[model samples]
Target: MDTSNEPHIAHKSHLPHPYDQDISHVLRHLSRITATGRKKLANSLSTAGYLAAGMWLIERNLGPDAARSACASGSRRSLERPLLGFLSQRAVAAAVAENPPPFPSRGGVPRLRTTWRSQSDFIADLINFAMWPTNYHPGYLEQRAVTTKRLVVGEDFVRAVHETAYLHTAESVRMPSVRLSLALMVLADGDDRVQRVLTDTYRGYLSSWKQVYAEVLRARGLRLRAGLGLDDLANALSAATDGVILRSIGDPHAGVVDRGRERTLMGTVALAVMHGFLEPAEDSDGLTLEQAVHARLGRPRPSGATRSDALRGERNPNP
Candidate 1:
């Protein structure tokens, strides 16, 4: 764990915390989960969407150092075409391999080949469609807002975040937090570039959870205690996730790699923290420790790179 090239937090100002007066109304996304099944469905979609995109990039040999160079403020946009071409080729190759078509007859008239679209566009559109409503009719929007208030401070928000962490650390890919830690090691101490990236990425990454927590508090007819707010909670959670991830990687037998232990632990901590800020709601999603263990162990472990094997850039077992 030589962290010489990684970034470290020397101070808070370089990575300023997100500060907003109130929760934004964007939590309309999570509001759609009225039933237990729907919540699970939404969470699954979110998990697959993020993991797939990350694996696709990593399989293409992208690494943190490469991402940092490409993600430079002005250079990211220039990568669209090349990245798209590569993705298109991979897509076509996969399609051909999985569902081979008959070759065209030499005597037949030439058929036009479809042009390749950027894989990034495909992913962006997929995520956008999944997140936002397709129809903006007044009636639909109104109904949406009504459904959005279902779980402001209960287990739904916590579960979504928990599932995301589970998926990121699944056996199929290298643990993302480990990757981030290594990435930070490569940066100069307190470098503005690293700080900017951390702040912007964390702000965007945790925005949904923050909004959900705010809505939950409002629904519970409560507000955060003095000196504690949604932003503070979010930053704390981020730190916790990072800390636990580092620990798990460094010590796999510490119960983190023990099926649902990690997810359950984080979820419990979140619920406890919420209770500290607001009154406990009667309708909390009662995810008992036994249930968490059952659910976690029931699923087949994801196959591919596990442990630190993927860190060395060996062949990825996942597509």
Candidate 2:
């Protein structure tokens, strides 16, 4: 039978031409996923490959090859089953790549037990981790990365704080859009797994701030105020940062900082609010927190106070 004009014949003719478009689509999608995500997708592909092997066997025995002549028939039968299997596996790979799974831990949330060198060091590390591009993947996996990152980010934010006051002139703020957006979606969708991870992440992050604040107070020989705690300060800082990140992502002109004043103004205002709550530690020329506070508040200096007395809260009687 003549099959020259047949659809199957036409399809077989084009088979040797290569499906560049389909290959490009898969490559493009893979590029958007993280290295970790790609690993997960590769595992999925392995599983799908096994399944496809079984289907290929069944196709060889009883598929449409029986209806055509040997020349046209064998080619279609040899190619069609594997092609279908490949496409199916590709689809599965794409899905897995886009949504990599979270890591499982027996413990509640991982915490960093080591001490930070200083508050500045702690803040710098936190900023670097949070602002990194690696943590910005748009998936549950991204949330997991943040959860782990926060274990090190150590937590706490506040709006009525002066920390954000310096943020007005800050040049660039990094917002991990993919991770933050996933967090928002997880919270909205009520994904309990991601939510639990996020909670643990925050806890670990807040704990670090407590340590930082304690060290800061100790260096100045000052006590925490009766009504305040390290956790409170950390909470305020965290809130301010989250707010700024959200605002930055929502604004249409958020990336216009270089060429446009309006966008720069918007960024300044957002960053200012963030900075007010996250007051970076100041180097106060060898003064203690008590002395600094007293000076700022216009109170009389403690009688016979030395630098040691200022740091120790009271003069050493032996000296």
Candidate 3:
């Protein structure tokens, strides 16, 4: 099979000696097992247990020689580096596979409308799509922000931002790929190579989201207040999102909700951040912030958009 187009977990030079092919075989087998579901496994397994399970499966299929080679002469540590990469790659692949072609609209949240010019750019988009929330359909925000002649800079814009934050927090709490990502994060802490990959992944994730937020602001003729910039809002929201996800992981009911109201923890933090940063653009047709927000909330949602619908074309919203 021509794997030239397939995403690799690591560079050729970074793979462990003599075990790279073996690792690939092992991963393929693991994928098959997960897909077939012929055998049952424990629902809760520690990271170490997960690793052990992989090794056991590999040994079972390829025999003790493969397992012994991986453990010999500090090769086990080397082997682990690619495993972390595999997890990250798998998360990305699973996300992409779930949300296939026709860019943007098939998935609940649109795939980025931008085309990637390089492998790095493409990988970054895959990672971004994997992490995006999926409560709203494609063109949901766009339909609201852009009117017949011009972009509407009012309540719809504010509500769109708030909805994005709320859905991101809500979906991330239950996303399976997020669990794998969290595990990968903990495992990458001491490994320099894996840490580099993780750092790059997150940088790309942040950059993609920054662009989305910036585009949304541009579409609605909004700007950051005073000294604030797009980067500030993106970074703040990113940090808050991380904190919320972590808190929600530990306490299932924590960050996903805000006092049982219609808002979310992330929504509150996002709005607070926006309050300090977002403002009407000078060209917003003389619409003040208060007037824009107080505009009626009765406008009908765009066609095919729904708050309760399942994410079409994907298994999980946040991958």
User: lDDT values of the candidates?
Assistant: 0.40, 0.35, 0.44
TM-score (C-alpha, index-matched) for candidate 1: 0.37
**Candidate 1, after superposition: displacement of residue 251 in Å?**
1.4
- For model 3, the stretches where C-alpha displacement exceeds 4 angstroms are 2-155, 258-263, 283-319
- The residue-by-residue lDDT of candidate 3 on 25-94, one tens digit each, is 1121121245333111111111112233223332232221323235445765554224433323233333
Top candidate, metric lDDT: 3
- The lDDT, on a scale of 0 to 1, for candidate 3 is 0.44
- Every model's TM-score: 0.37, 0.32, 0.42
lDDT of 1 by residue, 98-147 (tens): 32112111110011011113333233222232223221223544543433
Cα error, candidate 1, residue 106 (Å): 30
Worst 10 residues of 1 by lDDT: 103-112
User: Which of candidates 1 and 3 reaches a greater TM-score?
Assistant: 3
How many backbone clashes does every candidate have? 8, 22, 1
Ranked by TM-score, top first? 3, 1, 2
Candidate 2, poorest ten consecutive residues by summed lDDT: 103-112
When summed lDDT is taken over every stretch of 10 residues in candidate 3, the lowest stretch is 38-47
